[model samples]
Target: MKKPPIWFWQIALLVMIFIIWHIATSPDLIPPIFFDNEYRAAFFFGEPAKIFNAIWVWFMSGEIYPHLWVTLQETLLAFAIGTLLGLAVGLWLGLTPLASAILDPYIKAMNAMPRVILAPIFMVWFGLGIWSKVALGVTLVFFIVFFNVYQGVKEVSPVVLNNARMLGANASQLLRYVYLPSATSWVFSSLHTSVGMAFVGAVVGEYLGSAKGVGYLIHQAEGAFDINTVFAGILVLTVFALLLDFVVTFAENKLLKWRPQQAETETT
Candidate 1:
């Protein structure tokens, strides 16, 4: 028979993971290796069966929808706002050396600062609302896109610039046709990380202070020492992030079609 497909191995790995998790946390199985009481292992790591049940119950009851919605709202809002701001600033500074020189220290300082601590300050200003989370996420996302776009603009080939200029291309035309197309790839490259950062910011803000969102659910579970519920929340968030990443990948494929495909080398 032909070798199993890649997805077969992928699913096999997932099944193997669950199998190992089940054995490790099962009261009837390997608990003796780690603990005297069978229940102790289940208590600490949590049984995979219980974790899945918690997730199932959550969806079946429709209780997770509102929280998931709130989280998604925060994430999308932050991602859009941050990307626009980063793109504008990155292009502005990349084009103007004098302005870039003046703001270099300040920009570096802000990027170097620990952004998490600003969450409390944002909560103070935005009053424990989604804005605070959005602000926190913007701080995280802004730098990644800003740096990437800035580099992309700076790295535009001088020969390319001379050709464009020699062709009598105006400044605006250069920006539209040359700079943007070059930076487009860099912006797309940073998007996945920026989106993940935005999600993290939303969750962390909710974890710190919020009435809803999956992070709040995890917080409540932690408070109750409900290990299975906590793990379920984590698994849900992981799935949610993967879904967002899939969206990014789909968009990347559509938008980056203009980019030439790199050929793979053959092996003997």
Candidate 2:
């Protein structure tokens, strides 16, 4: 028989996995490996029920919102600033061949380095404030977007460029109508991944040294051996990351209407 849509299979598989997870962790179900060490198993396998309970207590009790808000603020600020900078730099480099060729090695070298390890340096320079987190996030987001946009522009057909020039398109017009549209899809693809990187950067910065944020909350929970709370904070961060990705998808849909619908469907 012909297979069902990918979404159908994906949803079914996810549901099945969740059900299995729930069953495996239930107190009544004892795996052979956990029979001798139930307490350790509980810790390792995790109590889904208690995870939900902890989430309720932290959320319903209004204990987590303030910290969540702080984390969200930092995440969003970093995402916005980083995305804008990436767009500006990417567009400039992509449109200017000479500039791109000149800076290519330097850009690759920087991007190749272990950026996360530089979190401490950012903290030292920006002094553990929101700025440090923003700076770190910017570093993470910039290279991903830059490379994609540059490649996208480079991939544009020479024929298309010639046609636009023949139509009397000025440099600004060419950039707006040709180069940007050419790179828009690639930019969005990079952005979808970059959103998570931005969050990672912000959170890692918080983990290293911060007075607030979800990462800070997770750090505190770890120090106290509150694994449940650590997991809860992670869940919250994941939800926000998904939300940001959805926003990017929505924008991509709107902006790339000219692209083939089948391409979008296949990508999804």
Candidate 3:
């Protein structure tokens, strides 16, 4: 017999998970070993069918668009601003030994700090509007790209730098040709992670305080004990996050075609 395609297994796994989730959550579908009441299972875990239904209702009623748009705006703005700041600071510090040494301890301390606590401070400074959420997301995204770019610059071979210097390459020429290209790969490598962090920051900010966004929706659902709607909101965020990650991969492929391709494992 022929082997099934990889995608077949992927789809099958998702279907199986949904089936199990449905069974485990539907009242009377299974014994209430964990919960005192069979209804409590469905109440706490929520039924898969109802979760999907809640999503469908939100779309059909056209209620989720504005919220989604708000989240997308926050995420994109945060990603852009953070990436720019990271690129600039990383390039500067990575190139300047004195500056890097001066700020090394402070940079490490800031990166070590938990960013969630800063959300409240941002809310106070920027208010409950979109800027607060964007500010929170920038903090989340900045470090990842900063580290990657800094490392990339440091990774530039001394031999290559010497050759360029001997060839009379000026500072601007060396930066434009040597440093930027070396850092490009690292920047792209960090894109997926940084984008996800931006999404996380936006959602978290919205969860804490906001009148809009999917996180806001989930918060509202939680207050009302509407487990299905909460799950639906979560699902929406997850799906969009995945789509954004896919875009990053697609852009990487297009932009990095000049780079060597990795070998794929053959199924024998």
Clashing pairs in 1: none
How would you encode candidate 3's per-residue C-alpha lDDT over 193-222 as one tens digit per residue?
A: 999999999999999999999999999999
For model 1, state the Cα shift of residue 267 in Å: 17
On lDDT, the candidate that comes out on top is 3
The superposed Cα distance between candidate 1 and the true structure at residue 199, in angstroms, equals: 1.2
List the candidates ranked by lDDT, beginning with the highest. 3, 1, 2
Question: How does model 1 score by TM-score?
Answer: 0.94
> TM-score: which candidate is best?
3
* Cα lDDT of model 1 by residue, 44-107, tens digit: 9888999999999999999999999999999999899998899889999999999999999999
Worst 10 residues of 1 by lDDT: 258-267
For residues 1-268, write the lDDT of model 2, one tens digit per residue.
9889999999999778767766776656765464565456556556666767888898888988887787777777877787777777889987788998999899989989999988889888998778899889888888887788778887889999999999999999999999887877787777778888888988999998898888998899888877767777777888878888888789888887777765434433
Query: What's the C-alpha lDDT at position 34 in model 1?
Result: 62
Model 3 misplacement above 4 A = 264-268
TM per prediction? 0.94, 0.84, 0.95
Write the number of the candidate with greater TM-score, choosing between 1 and 2.
1
